[model samples]
Target: MKKSRILLSTALIMVLSASSVYAHPGRTDSNGGHTCRTNCTERWGLEYGEYHYHNGGSSSSNSSSTSKSSNSSSSVKKSGQSAKEIATQKAKKAQQEKEAAVKKAKQIKQAEKDGYADGLKDGYNGISNIGISKYQGAYNKGYKEGFAKGKLKLTNEKNKAYRAGYSAAQNGKSSVVPSIYQTNKALSDSYLQGFERFVIDVEKQKYYQMGYNDSFNMEKYIKPDFDNANHIRWYKEGFDAGKKKQAA
Candidate 1:
Protein backbone atom coordinates (compact mmCIF):
# COMPACT_ATOMS: atom_id res chain seq x y z
CA MET A 1 0.00 0.00 0.00
CA LYS A 2 2.86 2.43 0.84
CA LYS A 3 4.61 1.70 -2.47
CA SER A 4 1.34 2.41 -4.34
CA ARG A 5 0.93 5.82 -2.57
CA ILE A 6 4.53 6.86 -3.52
CA LEU A 7 3.94 6.04 -7.22
CA LEU A 8 0.69 8.04 -7.23
CA SER A 9 2.43 11.06 -5.60
CA THR A 10 5.27 11.05 -8.19
CA ALA A 11 2.71 10.77 -11.06
CA LEU A 12 0.69 13.72 -9.63
CA ILE A 13 3.87 15.90 -9.43
CA MET A 14 4.86 15.15 -13.10
CA VAL A 15 1.30 15.95 -14.35
CA LEU A 16 1.22 19.32 -12.51
CA SER A 17 4.57 20.48 -14.06
CA ALA A 18 3.65 19.31 -17.60
CA SER A 19 0.15 20.87 -17.43
CA SER A 20 1.63 24.25 -16.28
CA VAL A 21 4.07 24.30 -19.25
CA TYR A 22 1.43 23.39 -21.93
CA ALA A 23 -1.48 25.55 -20.61
CA HIS A 24 0.51 28.77 -20.39
CA PRO A 25 0.01 30.68 -23.71
CA GLY A 26 2.71 33.23 -22.57
CA ARG A 27 5.43 30.53 -22.55
CA THR A 28 5.93 30.43 -26.43
CA ASP A 29 4.76 32.53 -29.39
CA SER A 30 2.03 31.29 -31.79
CA ASN A 31 1.78 32.08 -35.55
CA GLY A 32 5.38 30.76 -36.20
CA GLY A 33 7.00 33.68 -34.31
CA HIS A 34 10.02 33.72 -31.96
CA THR A 35 9.82 33.10 -28.21
CA CYS A 36 7.04 35.14 -26.49
CA ARG A 37 9.52 37.39 -24.60
CA THR A 38 11.67 38.23 -27.68
CA ASN A 39 8.64 38.80 -30.01
CA CYS A 40 6.88 41.10 -27.54
CA THR A 41 10.09 43.19 -27.07
CA GLU A 42 10.60 43.50 -30.87
CA ARG A 43 6.93 44.45 -31.48
CA TRP A 44 7.12 47.17 -28.84
CA GLY A 45 10.30 48.51 -30.44
CA LEU A 46 8.54 48.66 -33.89
CA GLU A 47 5.60 50.52 -32.34
CA TYR A 48 8.02 53.09 -30.82
CA GLY A 49 9.74 53.55 -34.21
CA GLU A 50 6.39 54.09 -35.98
CA TYR A 51 5.31 56.61 -33.36
CA HIS A 52 8.56 58.58 -33.83
CA TYR A 53 8.19 58.52 -37.65
CA HIS A 54 4.58 59.79 -37.48
CA ASN A 55 5.50 62.51 -34.99
CA GLY A 56 8.52 63.52 -36.99
CA GLY A 57 6.54 63.63 -40.29
CA SER A 58 3.76 65.69 -38.73
CA SER A 59 6.30 68.06 -37.12
CA SER A 60 8.23 68.44 -40.40
CA SER A 61 5.02 69.15 -42.39
CA ASN A 62 3.85 71.73 -39.84
CA SER A 63 7.30 73.37 -39.79
CA SER A 64 7.40 73.59 -43.61
CA SER A 65 3.94 75.17 -43.74
CA THR A 66 4.84 77.65 -41.00
CA SER A 67 8.09 78.64 -42.76
CA LYS A 68 6.24 79.15 -46.05
CA SER A 69 3.57 81.27 -44.40
CA SER A 70 6.19 83.47 -42.72
CA ASN A 71 7.97 83.94 -46.01
CA SER A 72 4.74 84.84 -47.76
CA SER A 73 3.86 87.36 -45.08
CA SER A 74 7.31 88.96 -45.37
CA SER A 75 7.02 89.11 -49.14
CA VAL A 76 3.63 90.76 -48.92
CA LYS A 77 4.97 93.37 -46.52
CA LYS A 78 7.95 94.01 -48.78
CA SER A 79 5.73 94.41 -51.85
CA GLY A 80 3.46 96.85 -50.01
CA GLN A 81 6.43 98.91 -48.85
CA SER A 82 7.86 98.93 -52.37
CA ALA A 83 4.61 100.31 -53.75
CA LYS A 84 4.49 102.98 -51.06
CA GLU A 85 8.09 103.98 -51.78
CA ILE A 86 7.38 104.24 -55.49
CA ALA A 87 4.32 106.38 -54.85
CA THR A 88 6.23 108.63 -52.48
CA GLN A 89 9.00 109.11 -55.03
CA LYS A 90 6.47 109.94 -57.73
CA ALA A 91 4.75 112.48 -55.49
CA LYS A 92 8.06 114.14 -54.61
CA LYS A 93 9.08 114.27 -58.26
CA ALA A 94 5.75 115.80 -59.25
CA GLN A 95 6.01 118.41 -56.50
CA GLN A 96 9.50 119.36 -57.60
CA GLU A 97 8.39 119.66 -61.22
CA LYS A 98 5.45 121.84 -60.25
CA GLU A 99 7.68 124.13 -58.19
CA ALA A 100 10.17 124.37 -61.03
CA ALA A 101 7.42 125.21 -63.50
CA VAL A 102 6.05 127.92 -61.22
CA LYS A 103 9.52 129.42 -60.75
CA LYS A 104 10.14 129.42 -64.49
CA ALA A 105 6.81 131.13 -65.13
CA LYS A 106 7.61 133.85 -62.60
CA GLN A 107 11.01 134.44 -64.20
CA ILE A 108 9.44 134.65 -67.67
CA LYS A 109 6.81 137.10 -66.47
CA GLN A 110 9.48 139.28 -64.83
CA ALA A 111 11.58 139.17 -67.99
CA GLU A 112 8.62 140.13 -70.13
CA LYS A 113 7.95 143.10 -67.83
CA ASP A 114 11.30 144.62 -68.84
CA GLY A 115 10.89 143.72 -72.55
CA TYR A 116 13.12 141.39 -74.59
CA ALA A 117 16.22 143.59 -74.99
CA ASP A 118 16.45 144.72 -71.36
CA GLY A 119 15.95 141.11 -70.28
CA LEU A 120 18.97 140.12 -72.37
CA LYS A 121 21.13 142.79 -70.70
CA ASP A 122 20.12 141.58 -67.18
CA GLY A 123 21.30 138.07 -68.12
CA TYR A 124 24.87 139.35 -68.55
CA ASN A 125 24.77 140.79 -65.01
CA GLY A 126 24.08 137.31 -63.64
CA ILE A 127 26.99 135.88 -65.63
CA SER A 128 29.38 138.58 -64.33
CA ASN A 129 28.76 137.49 -60.71
CA ILE A 130 31.10 134.52 -61.22
CA GLY A 131 34.15 136.82 -61.17
CA ILE A 132 32.89 139.19 -58.45
CA SER A 133 34.90 139.28 -55.18
CA LYS A 134 34.90 141.46 -52.05
CA TYR A 135 31.41 141.43 -50.70
CA GLN A 136 30.81 145.17 -50.16
CA GLY A 137 32.70 146.44 -53.21
CA ALA A 138 31.34 143.74 -55.54
CA TYR A 139 27.85 144.31 -54.29
CA ASN A 140 28.11 148.05 -54.96
CA LYS A 141 29.83 147.56 -58.33
CA GLY A 142 27.42 144.88 -59.49
CA TYR A 143 24.44 146.97 -58.48
CA LYS A 144 25.74 150.11 -60.19
CA GLU A 145 26.98 148.45 -63.39
CA GLY A 146 23.89 146.31 -63.66
CA PHE A 147 21.65 149.32 -63.10
CA ALA A 148 23.47 151.63 -65.50
CA LYS A 149 23.66 149.03 -68.23
CA GLY A 150 20.03 148.11 -67.71
CA LYS A 151 18.99 151.76 -67.99
CA LEU A 152 21.17 152.50 -71.01
CA LYS A 153 20.00 149.37 -72.80
CA LEU A 154 16.40 150.11 -71.93
CA THR A 155 16.74 153.72 -73.13
CA ASN A 156 18.41 152.73 -76.40
CA GLU A 157 15.97 149.94 -77.15
CA LYS A 158 12.95 151.99 -76.11
CA ASN A 159 13.77 155.11 -78.14
CA LYS A 160 12.42 153.71 -81.37
CA ALA A 161 9.91 151.64 -79.42
CA TYR A 162 8.47 154.75 -77.76
CA ARG A 163 8.38 156.59 -81.11
CA ALA A 164 6.70 153.61 -82.71
CA GLY A 165 4.24 153.45 -79.82
CA TYR A 166 3.54 157.16 -80.11
CA SER A 167 2.98 156.86 -83.87
CA ALA A 168 0.76 153.90 -83.29
CA ALA A 169 -1.16 155.76 -80.57
CA GLN A 170 -1.54 158.79 -82.81
CA ASN A 171 -2.80 156.43 -85.46
CA GLY A 172 -5.41 155.27 -82.86
CA LYS A 173 -4.11 151.90 -81.62
CA SER A 174 -3.75 152.83 -77.91
CA SER A 175 -4.08 149.16 -76.89
CA VAL A 176 -0.73 148.28 -78.57
CA VAL A 177 1.53 149.67 -75.80
CA PRO A 178 1.53 147.34 -72.84
CA SER A 179 0.74 149.02 -69.49
CA ILE A 180 3.63 147.16 -67.83
CA TYR A 181 6.10 148.57 -70.33
CA GLN A 182 5.08 152.15 -69.52
CA THR A 183 5.23 151.47 -65.78
CA ASN A 184 8.68 149.84 -66.20
CA LYS A 185 10.14 152.97 -67.78
CA ALA A 186 8.56 155.23 -65.17
CA LEU A 187 9.92 153.10 -62.33
CA SER A 188 13.39 153.05 -63.94
CA ASP A 189 13.40 156.86 -64.22
CA SER A 190 12.35 157.21 -60.62
CA TYR A 191 15.05 154.74 -59.51
CA LEU A 192 17.70 156.60 -61.53
CA GLN A 193 17.04 159.93 -59.79
CA GLY A 194 17.62 158.51 -56.31
CA PHE A 195 20.33 155.99 -57.21
CA GLU A 196 22.32 158.34 -59.45
CA ARG A 197 22.42 160.96 -56.69
CA PHE A 198 23.52 158.34 -54.19
CA VAL A 199 26.29 157.07 -56.48
CA ILE A 200 27.59 160.59 -57.32
CA ASP A 201 27.89 161.32 -53.59
CA VAL A 202 29.58 158.00 -52.90
CA GLU A 203 32.03 158.12 -55.84
CA LYS A 204 32.94 161.87 -55.54
CA GLN A 205 33.01 161.94 -59.36
CA LYS A 206 30.60 161.33 -62.19
CA TYR A 207 30.68 157.55 -62.56
CA TYR A 208 28.03 157.59 -65.26
CA GLN A 209 28.14 159.33 -68.61
CA MET A 210 26.24 162.59 -68.34
CA GLY A 211 24.23 164.54 -70.94
CA TYR A 212 21.87 163.16 -73.54
CA ASN A 213 22.85 162.00 -77.01
CA ASP A 214 22.13 164.20 -80.07
CA SER A 215 19.10 162.15 -81.06
CA PHE A 216 17.36 163.07 -77.79
CA ASN A 217 14.92 165.93 -78.55
CA MET A 218 15.32 167.83 -75.25
CA GLU A 219 13.75 170.97 -76.78
CA LYS A 220 10.63 169.10 -77.66
CA TYR A 221 10.18 167.73 -74.13
CA ILE A 222 11.79 170.44 -71.96
CA LYS A 223 10.73 173.60 -73.81
CA PRO A 224 7.55 172.47 -75.43
CA ASP A 225 5.72 175.86 -74.88
CA PHE A 226 8.67 178.20 -75.61
CA ASP A 227 8.45 180.20 -78.88
CA ASN A 228 11.78 180.54 -80.71
CA ALA A 229 10.71 183.59 -82.76
CA ASN A 230 9.42 185.53 -79.69
CA HIS A 231 12.69 184.82 -77.83
CA ILE A 232 14.76 186.08 -80.80
CA ARG A 233 12.58 189.22 -81.16
CA TRP A 234 12.90 189.96 -77.43
CA TYR A 235 16.72 189.65 -77.59
CA LYS A 236 16.96 192.03 -80.61
CA GLU A 237 14.70 194.66 -78.96
CA GLY A 238 16.83 194.59 -75.80
CA PHE A 239 20.10 194.94 -77.77
CA ASP A 240 18.70 197.88 -79.93
CA ALA A 241 17.49 199.79 -76.85
CA GLY A 242 20.95 199.29 -75.21
CA LYS A 243 22.73 200.67 -78.39
CA LYS A 244 20.49 203.87 -78.43
CA LYS A 245 21.30 204.54 -74.75
CA GLN A 246 25.05 204.24 -75.41
CA ALA A 247 24.88 206.50 -78.58
CA ALA A 248 22.87 209.25 -76.84
Candidate 2:
Protein backbone atom coordinates (compact mmCIF):
# COMPACT_ATOMS: atom_id res chain seq x y z
CA MET A 1 0.00 0.00 0.00
CA LYS A 2 2.87 2.36 0.77
CA LYS A 3 4.58 1.80 -2.61
CA SER A 4 1.23 2.32 -4.50
CA ARG A 5 0.54 5.56 -2.76
CA ILE A 6 4.04 6.85 -3.60
CA LEU A 7 3.53 5.95 -7.25
CA LEU A 8 0.18 7.72 -7.36
CA SER A 9 1.76 10.88 -5.92
CA THR A 10 4.55 10.75 -8.55
CA ALA A 11 1.94 10.55 -11.36
CA LEU A 12 0.07 13.55 -9.98
CA ILE A 13 3.31 15.57 -9.83
CA MET A 14 4.11 14.70 -13.47
CA VAL A 15 0.65 15.81 -14.70
CA LEU A 16 0.85 19.14 -12.77
CA SER A 17 4.34 19.83 -14.20
CA ALA A 18 3.08 19.21 -17.77
CA SER A 19 0.13 21.55 -17.25
CA SER A 20 2.37 24.33 -15.74
CA VAL A 21 4.74 24.13 -18.70
CA TYR A 22 1.89 24.51 -21.26
CA ALA A 23 0.41 27.41 -19.33
CA HIS A 24 3.78 29.24 -19.17
CA PRO A 25 3.19 31.04 -22.58
CA GLY A 26 -0.43 32.03 -21.75
CA ARG A 27 -2.69 33.16 -18.97
CA THR A 28 -5.05 30.47 -17.47
CA ASP A 29 -8.79 31.11 -17.34
CA SER A 30 -11.92 28.88 -16.96
CA ASN A 31 -12.73 29.31 -20.70
CA GLY A 32 -9.33 28.47 -22.24
CA GLY A 33 -5.83 29.89 -22.60
CA HIS A 34 -5.51 33.55 -23.62
CA THR A 35 -2.29 34.29 -25.55
CA CYS A 36 -1.35 37.67 -27.12
CA ARG A 37 -2.79 36.36 -30.45
CA THR A 38 -6.16 35.26 -28.93
CA ASN A 39 -6.33 38.36 -26.66
CA CYS A 40 -6.19 40.60 -29.75
CA THR A 41 -9.46 39.19 -31.15
CA GLU A 42 -11.30 38.26 -27.89
CA ARG A 43 -10.46 41.18 -25.57
CA TRP A 44 -9.86 43.97 -28.05
CA GLY A 45 -12.66 42.76 -30.45
CA LEU A 46 -10.41 42.82 -33.52
CA GLU A 47 -12.10 41.48 -36.67
CA TYR A 48 -8.88 40.27 -38.26
CA GLY A 49 -7.17 37.27 -36.72
CA GLU A 50 -3.81 38.00 -38.50
CA TYR A 51 -3.28 41.28 -36.56
CA HIS A 52 -0.45 40.02 -34.32
CA TYR A 53 1.16 38.11 -37.18
CA HIS A 54 1.48 41.21 -39.41
CA ASN A 55 1.59 43.85 -36.64
CA GLY A 56 5.25 44.89 -37.26
CA GLY A 57 4.87 45.09 -41.07
CA SER A 58 1.60 47.01 -40.84
CA SER A 59 3.07 49.45 -38.27
CA SER A 60 6.18 49.99 -40.43
CA SER A 61 4.03 50.62 -43.55
CA ASN A 62 1.82 53.08 -41.64
CA SER A 63 4.88 54.96 -40.31
CA SER A 64 6.35 55.19 -43.81
CA SER A 65 3.06 56.53 -45.21
CA THR A 66 2.78 59.09 -42.38
CA SER A 67 6.37 60.23 -43.00
CA LYS A 68 5.65 60.59 -46.71
CA SER A 69 2.50 62.60 -45.96
CA SER A 70 4.43 64.89 -43.61
CA ASN A 71 7.12 65.47 -46.24
CA SER A 72 4.47 66.25 -48.90
CA SER A 73 2.80 68.77 -46.59
CA SER A 74 6.12 70.42 -45.85
CA SER A 75 6.90 70.65 -49.59
CA VAL A 76 3.53 72.24 -50.32
CA LYS A 77 4.01 74.78 -47.53
CA LYS A 78 7.46 75.69 -48.79
CA SER A 79 6.18 76.04 -52.39
CA GLY A 80 3.33 78.28 -51.30
CA GLN A 81 5.67 80.46 -49.26
CA SER A 82 8.02 80.80 -52.22
CA ALA A 83 5.20 81.91 -54.48
CA LYS A 84 4.03 84.46 -51.90
CA GLU A 85 7.54 85.84 -51.55
CA ILE A 86 7.84 86.23 -55.32
CA ALA A 87 4.53 88.08 -55.48
CA THR A 88 5.55 90.39 -52.68
CA GLN A 89 8.82 91.17 -54.42
CA LYS A 90 6.99 91.96 -57.66
CA ALA A 91 4.57 94.28 -55.85
CA LYS A 92 7.41 96.20 -54.20
CA LYS A 93 9.21 96.56 -57.51
CA ALA A 94 6.08 97.87 -59.17
CA GLN A 95 5.53 100.44 -56.42
CA GLN A 96 9.10 101.67 -56.72
CA GLU A 97 8.77 102.01 -60.49
CA LYS A 98 5.59 104.02 -60.09
CA GLU A 99 7.24 106.37 -57.62
CA ALA A 100 10.19 106.88 -59.94
CA ALA A 101 7.89 107.67 -62.83
CA VAL A 102 6.00 110.22 -60.74
CA LYS A 103 9.24 111.85 -59.66
CA LYS A 104 10.38 112.05 -63.29
CA ALA A 105 7.11 113.59 -64.31
CA LYS A 106 7.38 116.22 -61.59
CA GLN A 107 10.90 117.06 -62.69
CA ILE A 108 9.71 117.47 -66.26
CA LYS A 109 6.90 119.79 -65.18
CA GLN A 110 9.28 121.93 -63.13
CA ALA A 111 11.68 122.16 -66.03
CA GLU A 112 8.90 123.36 -68.32
CA LYS A 113 7.93 126.07 -65.86
CA ASP A 114 11.52 127.23 -65.58
CA GLY A 115 11.88 127.25 -69.36
CA TYR A 116 8.74 129.31 -69.75
CA ALA A 117 9.89 131.87 -67.18
CA ASP A 118 13.24 132.21 -68.93
CA GLY A 119 11.55 132.67 -72.28
CA LEU A 120 9.34 135.43 -70.88
CA LYS A 121 12.34 137.22 -69.41
CA ASP A 122 14.23 137.04 -72.71
CA GLY A 123 11.25 138.31 -74.66
CA TYR A 124 10.82 141.25 -72.33
CA ASN A 125 14.53 142.09 -72.61
CA GLY A 126 14.38 141.89 -76.41
CA ILE A 127 11.47 144.30 -76.52
CA SER A 128 13.14 146.73 -74.14
CA ASN A 129 16.57 146.83 -75.83
CA ILE A 130 15.47 146.45 -79.45
CA GLY A 131 19.07 145.22 -80.00
CA ILE A 132 17.61 142.43 -82.07
CA SER A 133 18.83 143.14 -85.62
CA LYS A 134 15.30 143.12 -87.06
CA TYR A 135 14.58 146.51 -85.40
CA GLN A 136 17.97 148.23 -85.83
CA GLY A 137 16.83 150.70 -88.51
CA ALA A 138 14.40 152.54 -86.22
CA TYR A 139 17.04 152.81 -83.50
CA ASN A 140 19.48 154.49 -85.90
CA LYS A 141 16.94 157.06 -87.11
CA GLY A 142 16.12 158.19 -83.56
CA TYR A 143 19.83 158.54 -82.66
CA LYS A 144 20.59 160.71 -85.74
CA GLU A 145 17.68 163.10 -85.10
CA GLY A 146 18.46 163.63 -81.40
CA PHE A 147 22.27 163.99 -81.61
CA ALA A 148 22.40 166.35 -84.70
CA LYS A 149 20.07 168.91 -83.11
CA GLY A 150 21.84 168.53 -79.81
CA LYS A 151 24.96 170.05 -81.47
CA LEU A 152 23.06 173.30 -82.31
CA LYS A 153 21.44 173.72 -78.87
CA LEU A 154 24.38 174.55 -76.53
CA THR A 155 22.06 175.07 -73.50
CA ASN A 156 22.99 172.91 -70.50
CA GLU A 157 19.59 171.16 -70.21
CA LYS A 158 19.25 170.37 -73.90
CA ASN A 159 22.89 169.27 -74.11
CA LYS A 160 22.40 167.06 -71.06
CA ALA A 161 19.28 165.43 -72.46
CA TYR A 162 20.96 164.87 -75.83
CA ARG A 163 24.04 163.31 -74.22
CA ALA A 164 21.78 161.08 -72.10
CA GLY A 165 19.83 159.96 -75.15
CA TYR A 166 23.03 159.30 -77.11
CA SER A 167 24.46 157.29 -74.25
CA ALA A 168 21.26 155.23 -73.99
CA ALA A 169 21.24 154.57 -77.73
CA GLN A 170 24.84 153.39 -77.62
CA ASN A 171 24.28 151.13 -74.62
CA GLY A 172 21.04 149.58 -75.95
CA LYS A 173 18.97 151.06 -73.12
CA SER A 174 15.34 152.20 -73.17
CA SER A 175 14.59 155.80 -74.13
CA VAL A 176 14.11 158.43 -71.36
CA VAL A 177 10.80 159.78 -72.77
CA PRO A 178 8.92 156.49 -72.51
CA SER A 179 11.12 155.00 -69.79
CA ILE A 180 11.35 151.19 -69.75
CA TYR A 181 7.86 150.64 -71.13
CA GLN A 182 6.09 147.29 -71.24
CA THR A 183 4.68 146.10 -74.57
CA ASN A 184 0.96 146.44 -73.90
CA LYS A 185 -1.63 146.95 -76.66
CA ALA A 186 -3.39 149.90 -75.00
CA LEU A 187 -1.26 153.08 -75.19
CA SER A 188 -1.28 155.62 -72.35
CA ASP A 189 -2.65 158.97 -73.69
CA SER A 190 -1.16 160.82 -70.74
CA TYR A 191 2.33 159.49 -71.58
CA LEU A 192 2.00 160.72 -75.19
CA GLN A 193 0.88 164.16 -73.99
CA GLY A 194 3.80 164.33 -71.56
CA PHE A 195 6.23 163.44 -74.38
CA GLU A 196 4.82 166.14 -76.75
CA ARG A 197 5.18 168.89 -74.13
CA PHE A 198 8.46 167.69 -72.56
CA VAL A 199 10.99 169.66 -74.74
CA ILE A 200 10.34 173.19 -76.15
CA ASP A 201 13.32 174.41 -78.29
CA VAL A 202 13.14 174.35 -82.17
CA GLU A 203 16.17 172.05 -82.44
CA LYS A 204 14.72 169.99 -79.57
CA GLN A 205 11.38 169.86 -81.41
CA LYS A 206 13.01 168.07 -84.40
CA TYR A 207 14.77 165.78 -81.97
CA TYR A 208 11.46 165.01 -80.22
CA GLN A 209 9.72 164.37 -83.55
CA MET A 210 12.46 161.93 -84.59
CA GLY A 211 12.25 160.09 -81.33
CA TYR A 212 8.42 159.94 -81.47
CA ASN A 213 8.32 158.71 -85.10
CA ASP A 214 10.96 156.03 -84.49
CA SER A 215 9.29 154.89 -81.28
CA PHE A 216 5.80 154.54 -82.81
CA ASN A 217 6.77 153.25 -86.24
CA MET A 218 8.82 150.07 -86.63
CA GLU A 219 10.28 150.24 -90.13
CA LYS A 220 10.56 147.36 -92.64
CA TYR A 221 14.26 148.20 -92.71
CA ILE A 222 16.45 145.13 -92.29
CA LYS A 223 20.18 145.55 -91.76
CA PRO A 224 22.33 143.68 -94.27
CA ASP A 225 25.50 144.09 -92.22
CA PHE A 226 25.27 143.23 -88.50
CA ASP A 227 28.90 144.28 -87.83
CA ASN A 228 28.60 147.66 -89.61
CA ALA A 229 29.80 150.88 -87.91
CA ASN A 230 26.19 152.15 -87.72
CA HIS A 231 24.73 148.92 -86.28
CA ILE A 232 24.50 150.28 -82.72
CA ARG A 233 22.91 153.53 -83.96
CA TRP A 234 20.26 151.58 -85.93
CA TYR A 235 19.49 149.32 -82.98
CA LYS A 236 19.07 152.38 -80.75
CA GLU A 237 16.47 153.88 -83.13
CA GLY A 238 14.49 150.67 -83.18
CA PHE A 239 14.61 150.38 -79.37
CA ASP A 240 13.26 153.97 -79.09
CA ALA A 241 10.46 153.20 -81.54
CA GLY A 242 9.47 150.07 -79.66
CA LYS A 243 9.56 151.92 -76.33
CA LYS A 244 7.44 154.81 -77.69
CA LYS A 245 4.72 152.48 -78.99
CA GLN A 246 3.87 151.46 -75.43
CA ALA A 247 2.42 155.03 -74.94
CA ALA A 248 1.66 155.87 -78.62
Candidate whose TM-score is highest: 2
Q: Please, what are the lDDT tens digits per residue for candidate 2 over residues 1-248? A: 99999999999999887554334334433323222444444544333222122122123546776455444423211112567789999999999999999987666555544444433443423322222223344444443343444433323434344455455444555544443222321122223333433432333444445544555555543433446334445455655666756756
* Candidate 1 Cα deviation (angstroms), residue 68: 64
C-alpha lDDT of candidate 1 relative to the true structure: 0.43
RMSD list, candidates in order: 22.6, 24.1
Q: Candidate 2, overall lDDT? A: 0.45
Instruction: Report how far residue 237 has shifted in candidate 1, in Å.
Output: 17
Cα lDDT for residue 93, model 1?
A: 100
Candidate 2's error at 10, in angstroms? 47
For model 1, residues 1-248, the per-residue Cα lDDT tens digits are: 99999999999999887554423233322211122222323433322111112121223446776455444423211112567789999999999999999987665554443343333455333332223323444344445555566656666655545455545444545333455454555433433343443433333222111112211323221222325554434444444444454557
